[model samples]
Target: MSGIIALLDDVAAIAKVASASVDDVVGQAVKASGKAAGAVIDDAAVTPKYLQGFSAKRELPIVWKIARGSLFNKLVILLPVALLLATFAPFVIPILLMIGGAYLCFEGAEKVWHKINPSDHHSEELVSEKLSAAQLEEKKVKGAVKTDFILSAEIMTIVLNALPQDVSIWMTGASLAVAGIIITIVVYGAVALIVKADDVGLHMAAEGNSGFVQSLGRGIVRGMPTVMLLLVVIGTAAMIWVGGNIIVHALNELGWHLPYDVIHDLAVGAAASVPESLAGAVEWGVTAFLDGIIGLVLGLALIPVVTKLIVPLSSWLFPEKQATPH
Candidate 1:
């Protein structure tokens, strides 16, 4: 009887420890996800665009396809790379982060530039027009997945960096996996809702038993365009801010502290003018705003270089295959 009681106690202790470890992993994962908020927002915002022009019945299917690709990108591809880098080549992580940040900056700035100087160049759209419905759907899914790869890389890296330095390899992996799954579910789930909202609204408007329900449904349908535009704007701003923050922090880590110091000092100064309760918020906002400005400038500078040099070289090196629409 004594031996059996001791064995049961030992098992219970082990179970308690396992439960605690699981909780820790989940806690860390949520915190790391918060650190990668910019990329998360961008993922959510960008995904809906791929569903455009698809039949109502097909929208969810496309989202599912893209979500599957996103999962593969995060778990199968990027997760191993991130863990290896964390294990062996930790120094390279910051450099890769800066590169990813630069890309984000460039993308965000290009959007701003396009908004400021609207261009009629719809080359992709034109190409898409030539493809059959199935082909176009495939192309769009491929494009969205490719974009998600970059963003996922950034998100994973950010999550990895956010973790405590002394965390175990098992803990790190668990945290990252949890974060990736949570983020993927959140982003794609939101995309699914956003894309299907119009259909839902239409159905409700047609079938609702009450006038208020019908009116609300109509409002939802009418409001979707504005919601989409708002999402895009929010995503763009987030990318720039996060990109600039990453670049600045990376520079500081690399021993060039001028930008970091200047931003910190400026934020401190701004915060000093506010009440104590609001000081923290003010400081964060000032820092974010300044970082966004730097990101915007960097992005604008890269635009011409990317357009004039990178795109051309890329096209020369790996030309895209052309396919006619059926």
Candidate 2:
């Protein structure tokens, strides 16, 4: 009886430790996920564009397909890469992060430049006679999955960087897995809702028996365009702020801290000049604005290099056009 009691106590202790570890990992995962919110918001905002022109019945199904692809990208492709880097090539993490951050900056800046210039919108859709509906859907899904891979890489790297190096491998893995699953679900689920909301609203407006309910439905339908616009605005701002901050921090990590310190000192000085009740908000806003400015400038610089030099070089190296033997 004594031996059995001792064994039971040992098992209980093990269970307690396991439970504690889980709690710790999950806590860290949540915090780490927050650091990638800019990418998350950008993901959510951008995904709905993939549903355009698809039939109503096909929207959710298409989202599910893209969501599965995203999960695979995060778990099978990016997560292992993240872990391997964390374990072996830790120094490479920050450099890759800066590259991803620069990408975000370029995208955000391009959006701003367009907004200021207000160029005429032109549809780029090609009416290929050989392409069927299935092929078209497949092409769109592939494009979306490709885009998700880039965003997923950014998110996973950000999450990995957020973790402490002292953490055990198991702890790190658990945190990453949890974060990946949670973020994938949140992003795709939001995409589904956003894509379907207009249809649902239209249905309710057309079919609802009561006048007040129909009015509410019409309001929802009318508000969706504004909602989408707001999401884009929010996402663009987040990309610029987050991208610039990442680049600045990376520079700091690489022993070039002047830009970081200057931004910090300037923000603090501005905050000190503000009213006491609103000082914190003022500081954050100023910092974000300056960071966004940096992001914009960096992005604009890259635009020419990327468009003229990089694109031409890449085309010469990996030409998408191949001569077919007739």
Candidate 3:
């Protein structure tokens, strides 16, 4: 009986330790996830565009497929790669992170450039001529998944960097896993709602039993475009700001601290001019705006390189045949 009580006490201690570890993992995951908010917002914002031309009934299913792919990207691919970096190639994390940051800068800049010079922006037309609905869905899913891979890579790296260095390997993994799941659900769930809002509104407008309900439905339908535009604008700004910040911080890590210091000084100076209540907000806004400008400049520089060199190389490597019209 004494032996049993001793064993029970040991088990209780183990349970307590396990509970603490779980709490730690959850806390770390939430904190790290917050660091990747910009990327996550961009991801959520960007996804709705892919669903734009699809039929109403097909929207949720497509979102589900993309969400599944995103989960797979985060869990099956990025999670392992992040763990490998943490375990073995820890030194390379910063390098990979910078690369991702540069990509974001390029992307954001390209968006700004495209907005300024819309005529210059072009994509290899997805010749979906003969594709049936199922085929089209498959292609879109594949494209979304490909896009998700890039964004997910950025998110995972950012999260990994944000985590404490002293946590156990499993704890780190668990944190990442939790972050991935939570982010996936939040982003896709929001996308799903955004995409379906119009449909819901239309249904309510056309079929609602009350005048107020119908009016609300109309409002939703009309408001969707503005909401989408807002999302895009916010997402682009976030990408540029976050991308530039990442690059600045990465350069600092590499001992190039001038840009970081200058930006900090500028932010401080800007903050000094504002009221105490708004000082922080003003400072952050100024910093973000400057970072976006930096990102835009970098992206504009990369555009010529990407279009003239990268695109040609990619096309040469994977030439596409003409598709027959349906």
Cα miss at 150, model 3 (Å)?
2.7
Q: Model 3, 185-240: lDDT tens per residue?
A: 99999999999999899999999999999999999999999997887787777767
Per-residue error (Å), model 2, residue 258: 2.4
lDDT of each: 0.88, 0.83, 0.85
Which residue pairs clash within candidate 3? none
Q: What's the lDDT for candidate 3?
A: 0.85
Relative to the true structure, candidate 1 reaches a TM of: 0.89
Between candidates 1 and 3, the one scoring higher on lDDT is 1
What TM-score should be assigned to candidate 2? 0.85
**Per-candidate alpha-carbon RMSD to the true structure:** 2.6, 3.5, 2.9
lDDT of 2 by residue, 1-326 (tens): 99999999999999999999989999999999999887788788777766777798989999999999999999998888888988898888778878878887877777787678665222223332345777778877886887677788888888887888799888898899999999999999999999889888998999999998799899999998888777768767776777787798888888899999999999999999979999999888888888888998998888778878986897788675422110
**Superior candidate under TM-score, 1 versus 2:** 1
- The sequence of per-residue lDDT tens digits that candidate 1 reaches over residues 1-326 is 99999999999999999999999999999998999887798789877867778898999999999999999999998888999998999889889889988988998898898778775346655777778898989888997898788789989998998999899999999999999999999999999999889888998899999999999999999999898778778878887887898899899988899999999999999999999999999999999999999999999999999999998897778665322431
